[model samples]
Target chain A: MQQDAARLKVTHEGDIVQVEFTSRKILDEANIAEIGDQLSALVEAEHRPRLVISFAGVDHLSSAALGTLITINNKVKNRDGQLRLCNINPQIFEVFLITKLNTLFHIYPTIKEALESLRSGAQTGRLQ
Target chain B: MRPVFARVVTGTLMKHLKLQAGSRGRRESREKSVGLWCSEEFPSQMAEGRRVEEKILSQCRKYAYGQRDLFALKLALEEAICNAIRHGNKSTPNKHVRVKYRITRERIDVMVEDEGSGFDPAVLPDPTADQNLERACGRGVLLMRAYMNNVVFNSVGNSVMLTKFNESYSSSDTPINSTTVAFG
Candidate 1:
């Protein structure tokens, strides 16, 4: 399955950190339902300005993905950090539009844009 | 052709024909019946029911004839099926939940049956109240009633049958399509 090859890579650059959770479709909600608590613990430990969600591997998303993203963002904000999504595939983007969640959080075409915006302090609620 | 290969080819062709014929019959039957039927084993063959629900939504949304009505049906069906899995059977493997869907000219019908002991449907706490909104739980059953045109609990809460009506069907006489399914 696509999720079997998925990875959540964690890397840091001097107080700047990027943690990405990559997954495929069947891994969508069941993954969140299973790992949400683990994500909560991880968010509680980090203090950073940006979190990147590489949607390169995702096939489809649903209300569960939206809810999970929102919950994680809340957890990050509690730690004074923000969540950014990057490399969103077309199928998942369609869902984002359908749900009108494109308005909820920062999104970028690539990780470079996300990091650059964060460093430049273009602080905003959500970017299309 | 090799005997085994020939058999395999014939078998696959027959299966494809059966499925194609089944699809046609199902479409024709649904014109009047508007019902979905399958065995409890269907869930085990698949991972979860929500994905199935979404597929059904996309397939049947046009039949709903209105976006809001479509959305309501989607939400109500999700809650009903989720409850059938979570609350009714508590997601227990030992228990089987059977779902049957039917839509008449006016009303949509969904019947959910679980193998577990029944409960009182009346005692569910209201999730819309101020105190319950943020808890992230307890809203499934209430939302079912909110979106469905009607809700009925059988002799016990082990089974629930939900119904919704299209306003058009009520105002004008709707012709029921009469067809029996053929799968050969």
Candidate 2:
């Protein structure tokens, strides 16, 4: 029904929902909305209550995409869920740091680290 | 197929290239300014801004713009386009968004115009403010102003022009100032 996980890859790892962007760069306006909707649906699918957006494949993303992240973060917040972002490239990381979004998100350096945090309920801000 | 010849000239010399077609000759004069133009009707298609940005970035590289400036311009231009599309046009497919970027050795000037009614930049709440930090889309204008050397808006507020001067390296390839960007 959902493009067979075309835009992003969704997987479950021990009660953690990991959403991986399929594109190397999610800079398009139309794609941003699609991503937001997909993440929202994931939030609604079952009661994982823990989400992690992996940027391992992404290099660049526009501010609109950042806005989408904010929307998704807010949605997760409202649902009493936790969202973690990991494997963000340096350039994209600069955007988060510039906008001070680094403070709002629990960012990890790797997907494994993020998963471990989710399992252990550890909160981290920015990857140093 | 006939071969096309391109020449590179320095200084203020007027360079002309002659293209031969049959018995006629066409003389093309090279201009010093490099520019990119794009127009989209709202609700605009996805990645239109990114496409325009790619073109502008290519032009910047062709003009030997420094990487720092190129990155700053990319961010500033993208933000301006987003503002025009999302705020000025309100994502209405009927309205049109226009973007133009003119880059010279001295500076890069970008203009973004939208069909929607103008807005008051003065009235915009600071996106970095504590109360407004979580807002979805209020930081575009601020980023543009922060990254570009000069940002000016028309009286109607539907159009904005951003300018960024070349840092250190001018048309003569000499360092003027090391400052890459300025905040206002």
- Which candidate number maximizes DockQ? 2
| Candidate 1 residue lDDT tens string, A70-105 | 677777777788777777776557545544456666
TM-score of each: 0.51, 0.76
| Candidate 1 backbone collisions, by pair | B34-B103
Candidate 1 global lDDT:
0.57
What does candidate 1 score on TM? 0.51
Write candidate 2's Cα lDDT for B1-184 as tens digits: 1122222332232111111111122221113332222233223333665667777678778777886788778878778888887787787766666665556666676677887788989999877676776788777877787778878888899888888876635443332221222111
List residue ranges in candidate 1 displaced over 4 A: A1-7, A26-30, A97-100, A125-128, B1-36, B41-83, B87-89, B92-95, B101-184
Scoring model 1 with DockQ, what do you get? Answer: 0.06
Give the CAPRI class of candidate 2: acceptable
Instruction: For model 2 chain B, give the 10-residue run with minimal summed lDDT.
Output: B14-23
TM-score of 2: 0.76
